[model samples]
Target chain A: MQERTVKITNRLGLHARAAARLVRQAGQFKSAVELKREDTGQTADGKSILGVLLLAAAQGSRITIRTEGPDEERAAAALLQIVEEKFGEEAPDGLF
Target chain B: MDSSNTSHSRNSKLKGLAASPGIAIGRVLRLDERGRRQFYYMEVSAQQARTEIKRLREAFAEAHARLKEIRSNLKGELGGQHEYILDAHLLMLEDKHLIAEAEREIRSRRINAEWAVRNVADRLAGAYRHIKDPYLRERSADIEDIATRLLTTLSGHTRFNMSTLDQDVVIVAETIWPSTVGELDLNHVLGFATDTGGLTSHSAIIARAVGLPAVVGLHEITKNAGTGDAIIIDGAAGEVVLRPTKPIIRTYIEKRDLDRERRVEASVRSSEPATTLDGVRITLRANVELPAEIESLALFGAEGIGLYRSEFLLLNRLPELPDEDEQYQVYRKLAEATGEHGASIRVFDLGGDKLSLDGFEEEKNPALGLRAIRLSLKAQEIFRTQVKAILRANSHGKLRIVLALISTLDELRDAKRIIEEVKRELAESGAVHDPELPLGVMIEVPAAALMADMFAREADFLSIGTNDLIQYLLAVDRANENVAHLYQPLHPAVLRTISHLVRVAEKAKAPLELCGEMAGSPIQAIALVGLGVRTLSLAPASIPLVRNAIRSIDQSRVRALLAEAVKLATTGEVEALLGRQLPRQAPQFFAALSSLG
Candidate 1:
């Protein structure tokens, strides 16, 4: 398993659209992707939008992304990159 | 099952908001969702669990297909602008956690698929409700929406099959979503009575658009009603009678027939002008929100579209405002549809309780805060785009611009200046538009009504939006049950304020129209015409009744009645005077009104 912790960079945090993008991205890999909120200890399936939303990860919150099985390395790297890039949203997250 | 012979059978009435105008008596079809937090729960055997799982899978597949179809259809119409929201819904449907969690509950808890699904959805929604962010909290509604769809599918009442219902029935539910109303087959459905919704809710709007008799906000109609119970819905009176006695049913049938006959008579005479006996011509127009409602204008004999609320367009495409081109197309369609009579497109009245835009902070008093004209002025970019679109569509038909909630002279002047700026830009761009397009001000705010003389002089036309005016003038919130009784239309203050507006508009020689709930009622229409108002705009269904009322009354007598009514000290006195005097003057209109009750 490959795991990496990252902070929510988008101002709106893990909102519907942002969570949707993450889930769609997670679905592309042949790995079981899961997310765990650091402070709340809440865990969610990265492939489920509802589960990801259940984390309610607000801005500046830290979450750990864990991926297992065949494409774990790529899945973890891709998710980490997306989180760092703020889900390709504009700076300050104006596209509400 | 002959309940009529049983003395124990309960006969009860439910009071709710009069969402649509008409009468319907039929057997009840209680659509799923017995209550907001309650569902049909049952246990299943080990072998039956497998069958339940298969049923759930099929339901998911059906819901997935329906969502995709709706997405593609919306994409075709809106150029894929709103696909992101639908895409999110699609992803939720495909969520492994949602599906697997429900399946696991059905197996472990030995409950039915519907119960399992509801259990999982409630948990998820409960979590979402606790979310501190308002935007994230609203996501719970989406989950509930999906669960309702699944439940409906599991109930074997898929929207597609609603049309195949063998018998006509009145739909009783906790709350019917607006989208579901569109999918219902009107042929088999007589009307709707729900536990929740107000007069201006989207479901109510759809019910009006389709001409279905609906009574909402009943609180517990679904609990009192069972599938196939004898039901009667008086949409005009906002009453729902369940398991009605035979005699009550017969009386309602008579009332229904008489109402239908009167409507037919009104419709037949609808083509004639609404001229008073003394030769004053009254122009009757429609207050519409959707394009679908425009088709009923001719049927109801509305001469033109008076108040076309443009906020509906915004409501459909929320969080993201429709761009100039998108708004232009809708405005253009409205202009062309209204034809020579023209349409007055009011700028979007956002804020308040209507809709909360992304950037707007939660206000303690939204009704008195940045709403209507204030929001438009503050959000100049959105205001400018809408004004530019209205101007661009002016070339198609006789279109007028109406601004809502202009409480100050500066607000009116600023809105006019912005409109002028947009017009100038369009002119410079060589866009074909009506250069002489008229601009009107909605006299809804108390301050606006007080400054009617100045507004009438500056505005090309004036419209009295009595709904807000009455609410503000009386300091009564119509939505608050405690104070709603004080929100009277015939209140002495309301009449005097309207009388002042009419006199000022006449002095300025500006065309004035009253477009509000007051104008829709036959009794109030009489009072308004008596007060020197000549043009009235109301819902299309109300036009026939108001026209018949207008045709039946002699203006001279009503004017004399108004003279006495304005001197009354209270709403009760004014109402009593009109109730006693109007029937004598317009017996035909009174007879029709009596038939409805």
Candidate 2:
């Protein structure tokens, strides 16, 4: 299993729209990804947007991710890529 | 000049209205070749006339089918009424009497089929002009609609409604129909100047809905605007300028762009939450009426939908109930749209501004009548259907259910009992639904806010419906234009109620939020955050400004201010303190929103 604790840098933290984008990216990998808030220890399916949002991880909160599969390294890397990039700096076009 | 001083009758000009609003310096495309627009029925045997009628019927059927398909695809965007309008057209055109009359006229007059169709079209169109209901009367276009269809079928050509004229055009008409609005190419169109319609009328509604600039109720505009005449349409001020000077045009153009840019920025910034300078967070959500409104969440940056106002399904129709599945579809869309943050759906808050009950005869007062939680108590079945739908949609995303206008603990208890009843019903029916549904109440009336401590202990959460809370606490009917000035959201009494409720909620460690107009207003939002209100629900458009205000404040100082403001004796004293402290931190938002008071 690959695991890492990352600070939620995006102003919104891991809210709904961000979770959706993260889950979409996570699903691209063959690895099974799971997220857990550092403080609450609430576990969520990294690929299910609903499970991620229900956690309500606020801005500045820290969360940990766990991955297991042949592509675990790639999944963790890509998921971190989105968090680090701040989901492309702007919300998706036509979001409203 | 008066009939050579003998007849004493002044000459008058017949007014054939240009119906669509616009002033254009283009060649008159007067639709004058009425006969040429249609194909004539050839002089043939009775048998051929019958066959020709059959062919026309078939053509009409095909056209109706196509129109229905177009209407169905557009149902979500244009709403159900548009489809009904098309259906009305099909029924009127296919009326047996009307169709047979035209065929009879064709055979008897021994004239072309074009003349016969025109005669029938004119009669039907004229009948609609006198109908009492304005919406129905406007259906006269259905006759013109049929004529256009027949003309297209007969002439093997389609007439384009939009003209690419070289000169500037300001549309002047009695009323601009939606279809005409849809057909026009706005590139060459300057603006719409209409003779009739108030702010909420169809033309005004459509113009606002479609981002068009329009000024209505300009009487005699048809006579005022001439071909090749220059005109300026000022929709904001409801004025039309004829032969405007170059400087005036330049000034208007600048104002138009500035207004457009501000609106664009507001929309763009709407999608974020309010965070204080010290990083204190406040939830900002949108108020929506339809499922499609969910699409705006990202644009508005709302945390979730604060007020769902689910009464839409029950209002404006027969008092029939909507089943769980139908309600689930709407709730699910909202829940899903909030992405992961989820939405708070206030169960059908009917009665205040809306009336759907059958037995509630005319009352001397409606604001204090049986409404909101009271109505739900009366209509158990209607209430259960809403609860069931909400519970079912819980599987889709984060969903919280709140009951509005709750006044007593007993009301909350009674609502809980009904929710239990719905749970039992859902289980007995083996329906798929979330078993654990967290329910809350709106702390609006003074009694509710005063006793919120007890109710917060009973319910999972509480949402302060500020609009009602302010009105009820101050004994002000906000809708009454006469006393609307007294609708004070920042009143110390209202703030104290909020402060008390938040304290109680904090003691119980219960979730609490505010879903009211006050939650969106700049000064009120700052005061709310000062009172420790972390979650706020507002209109989508207000999200950015509210967020900007929150981001500019120091949370600890705000708390201190709230502590001081609450101790004040009167609402006026509290208002004075807030006026001094808040604007210093958020001068722009405070200045813009203070005028709203």
Cα TM-score per model:
0.70, 0.53
What TM-score does model 2 achieve against the real structure?
Answer: 0.53
lDDT value for candidate 1?
0.83
Which candidate number would show the highest TM-score if scored against the true structure? 1
Query: lDDT of all the models against the reference?
Result: 0.83, 0.66
Per-residue lDDT tens digits of candidate 1, residues B98-154? Answer: 888889988987766777778788888888999888888999999988988887677
Candidate 1 segments whose C-alpha is farther than 4 A from its true place: A1-96, B1-10, B17-19, B27-116, B119-189, B196-206, B226-230, B245-251
TM-score of chain A of each: 0.95, 0.88
lDDT of 1 at A24: 93
Best by lDDT: 1
Candidate 2 segments whose C-alpha is farther than 4 A from its true place? A1-96, B1-253, B266-273, B567-577, B587-597
Q: Flag clash pairs in model 1.
A: none
Give per-residue CA lDDT, model 2, range B351-464, as digits (tens): 664544676675567778888888888887788878888888887887888888888899899999888988898899998787677788888888888888898899999988
Error (Å) of candidate 1 at residue B187 is: 6.1
> Residue B165 error for model 1, in Å?
5.0
Q: How good is the docking of model 1, as DockQ? A: 0.43
At residue B53, candidate 2 shows an lDDT of 59
